[model samples]
Target: MDPLTIGILGFCALFVLLFIRMPVGTSMMLVGAVGIYMIRPQASLPVLAGEIFGEASNYSLTILPLFILMGNLAGVSGMSRDLYNAAHSWFGHLKGGLASATIVGCAGFSSLSGSSLAAALTMGRVSLPEMQRFGYDNGLATGAIAAGGTLGILIPPSAGFVVYAILTEESIGRLFMAGVVPGVLLTALFITAIWLIVRRKPEKAPQSVTAEPVSKRMASLGRAFWIIGIIVLTIGGIYTGVFSAVEAAGVGAFLALIVTVIRGAASWENIRDVSLQTLKSTGTVFLILFGAFVFKTFVGFTGIPFRLTGWVEAQGFGPTAVVITILVAYIVLGTFLEGFAILVLTVPLVQPILQSLGVDLVWFGVLIVIVLEMALISPPVGINVFVVKGIADNVPLNTIFRGIWPFWFAMLLAAVLILVFPQIALLLPNTMFG
Candidate 1:
């Protein structure tokens, strides 16, 4: 069979494996190995083993475990609760204020945790019950948490970004830097959407707050300064070249551990728990990454990505149109696939097409992340939505979906903004790395 035909069959087989409930990493690795053996029988096994080992052992990949450890440590330390309380004190008095605070709190927690499920589950446990007690709409309450949780991937220290960086050979630090402004912009857009919704139908969000003393509010903010300090030390250190991305992860993890211990949050038992959780999450990511490496290598050997890119370039679509098409494809796949699955499956195919079109890879990276963020909150398999639903069992799944619409719209707005003004994504990386 022609390499193109073999490539198509291999991908089809991978999808079939995915449909049969095979683990994504295993499915990809299996298909990739078979495809490689088919294409070059003599060298396939050794090549696959070497690629897997090389990809798995990269120093840059070490950041994944450390950042995840930092997030787990922060969770155990009860920092998210303090941050949520601080957000509520400031915004809880406004119409739809509790929901607004939930979104804000999620963004703050995303900055710390860098994992959508962690952000959603953590904040849902902390905020949902309070919103329920205040008579907030179930949809709004759940939606805010679900949607806001997606910021975990777009903000710095993002595991998804790390994976993307590793897959594309982009600078992890530059990609992390690229995310900051876009992340803040998306968060602001979500907040604005909530404000607009409440403004339009004030009855939807009835506010009931016993105002805290100003002193108490000040104290709440004071206690949350650790989040600010961690962000500055970790991200600021990266941008300033004080540490490489992996070292920044270590710095953040160490700082988070120190703060958690100082606050009496991280006992030996808690440390044990954090270590186990980090190991599980990190292992999962690395396994998937290794599979992706094998699959991408197969695709490269098959010449599929090159042929596809050349074909697309020949079709003469405008760069903007082609970019939109890729994003639309993500939305469709996102309905069923997890964000990481989509990233691993499509990035190799998409990156070459993007580069051939003369689009900036870093800008495209940020844009792809925004689309993946939407997928995280999308229905059915929207992981973050289910996470919030699991936390607030009484809240219907449909209600959670309903609540995420405004935030979804906000994400769309943010995507358009980035699409139109690539500078939002590019400025930070260029300014720092140039």
Candidate 2:
């Protein structure tokens, strides 16, 4: 068979392996190794060894563990509750206000953590019971937390953006700045989705206790200062060039450490748990990253990216059609593959097409992250839904899936808006850095 045929079959086989409960990193690496051996057995062993050790030592990746440490450390600290309470104080009286507060809390926590799974797990634990106590509809209640967790990837300090930056060779700071505006827009869109649902269904989101006195509200706001301060300093420092993404990660981790200690969660056991969790999460990411590099190397040898792009260009599709087709493919893939895997597998094929079309790589990166955000909430493989399910076990899996529908479509609308007005994803990066 020709190289492209082998590559195609290898791709399908990787998915099959994954479906049979294989680890993503192992699956990708196995297929890549076997494929490379088929083509060049003499070179395969050295290449695989180089990818494993070389990827571990890659300097660009130093930021990953630092960021993960900050998130895991901050997650254990009491900010999730503080953030939720702060948002609850301000918006709790509005229709769907508690649910809205949950989104706000998720957004704030995501900035601190840079992780969707951590955000979903933390916020689900913090907010679900409160929403349930408020007599909110189960679908609306679980759905809001599930959907809100998606922000973890779209907000600044996002691991997804960091990985994308590494893959695309873009400036991590600019990619991060690019995420800010769209992150805000999507947060608004999600809140709006909650509003429409409440407005139409009426009983889905009953009025919250918006009647708190000003003093009580101020107290709640005061409680969230740690979240606000960490976000502004790290993200703001990145925009102004006071810190590179790596530096920001280090500083964020240090500050989070200080806060954890100051809050007296500094017990050795707590620190150990946080550190262990950080190590595990970091290991998973890097393992997958290693596999991606090896697999991408193998794929590169196949010339599939070039052939695929050539064939698509030959068909003479309009720029808009090509873009739409790529996005539609992401949506479909989102239902089955995890977002990072989808990104790793497709970027090699898609990047050249995008570069050829004269698309802005930074803007496209932001768009990709946004779609991945939707993927986290998309049914079936909606990873965030599973995260929430692990915490809110009494809620049926289907109900959580049903609840996320509005937020999923809202994310789609947000993606459309960004495409129509590229500046939504570009404005901050362009103005702040360029």
Candidate 3:
């Protein structure tokens, strides 16, 4: 009958719903509604309606659709292929070069598409066959693509960061800026992991018979210049304070449309397809956010976050110990939960605890995104691995899972470095926003 008891039962019921294959957003909404009604009968329906209107009318969330549109347009314009080709021209001759190139290409595409599934699906389609043609082992090839795709949520324009910012009421621009260094650091670590993999098992990735000529490589880079320019124009504009994150999203989407047209890739069918896909993705995100807000409100009413924070204090856990404990829980949850689900489900409970500990939120955002990145490749429900498996249908699930280990470890290293040196996540945001 107590609020905390109601909250506990609600969570158990919510997980049972999830186990029965209910949609996350709907499940959250249902549990939250029932919990609210149980706690206060008259408040439940009005609160649900109010939260829906609040999330729907939020002006800051305008960035979501624009960014999603930009990514969809970029995908339709063949930018992912161009990025992969340019990376291949530069790195494809080295041991494990194609796999390395795949990581680089994923990083590049991540700048364009902020969704991990989009990055994984797009790059997996573009890079997998090329690696196969070159006789790269299926595990190494698919693993690189799967792991690399996780970069999409850590790089600028990241939907993960956007959701985090929205949930925490932090500055989205600052979060975007904060993600930059850590994203590049993770990319480099992924490439290094590939190098180590091939060093130990050279036969996994065959050396190219001959490297491409400098002129050809330069030409390939040229083909990718438009995408590079769009990235600079949007992300660079934000860094220099010339454009807000929302404005950058608009301009980026517009430019992507222009480039799509110029490349003669814009047909009625392509336009229709991209538009519909964007709508579907955007709708899904909004639904999740709506559920998250209602669930957050219910949790707030229960006062669980405050109690948890108090419990931590009573335990005399230092800030470092508290953070480690939270992250370890995240790692365990990441194995079974989708990244966004992990985020929306936990952040309402966790944010106050971190804030009470005087943790820098922007730095914590970067760290959280990295863990979410790790989730994308974790196991069982590692969605990025599934995305890769969808593309490389013949590659065994275990092989792809095996391949992602090194990159997953690389992600773990990135998290550790960011944890040790918060500057790795904070420098850009501070330099730009302060």
lDDT for every model?
A: 0.88, 0.87, 0.91
Choose the strongest candidate by TM-score.
Answer: 3
lDDT of 3 by residue, 149-221 (tens): 8999999899999999999999999999999999889899998998898999889999864799999999999
Query: Which residue ranges in model 3 land beyond 4 Å of their true spot?
Result: none
Model 2, residue pairs in steric clash: 93-210
State the local distance difference test value for candidate 1: 0.88
Q: TM-score per candidate, in order?
A: 0.97, 0.97, 0.99
Tens-place lDDT digits, model 2, residues 1-434: 67888899889898899899788888889999998888778878988999899889888788888887887777778867888899999899998999999999899988978888988888889888988988899999999998898898889788998888877888888988999999899899999999999999989877767578999999998988887788899998988889988899899999989988889888999999998999999999998888887888889877888887788789887666877788889999999888988888888788888887778889988879888888888878889999998988899999999999999999999999998999999999999877
Of candidate 1, the 10-residue stretch with the lowest lDDT total is 202-211
Best by lDDT: 3
Each model's backbone clash number = 0, 1, 0
Full ranking by lDDT? 3, 1, 2
Worst 10 residues of 3 by lDDT: 316-325
Q: For all the candidates, what are their Cα RMSDs to the real structure?
A: 1.3, 1.3, 0.9
Ranked by TM-score, the better of candidates 1 and 3 is 3
Candidate 1 off by > 4 Å: 210-214
TM-score, candidate 1, is 0.97
Residue pairs in clash, model 1: none
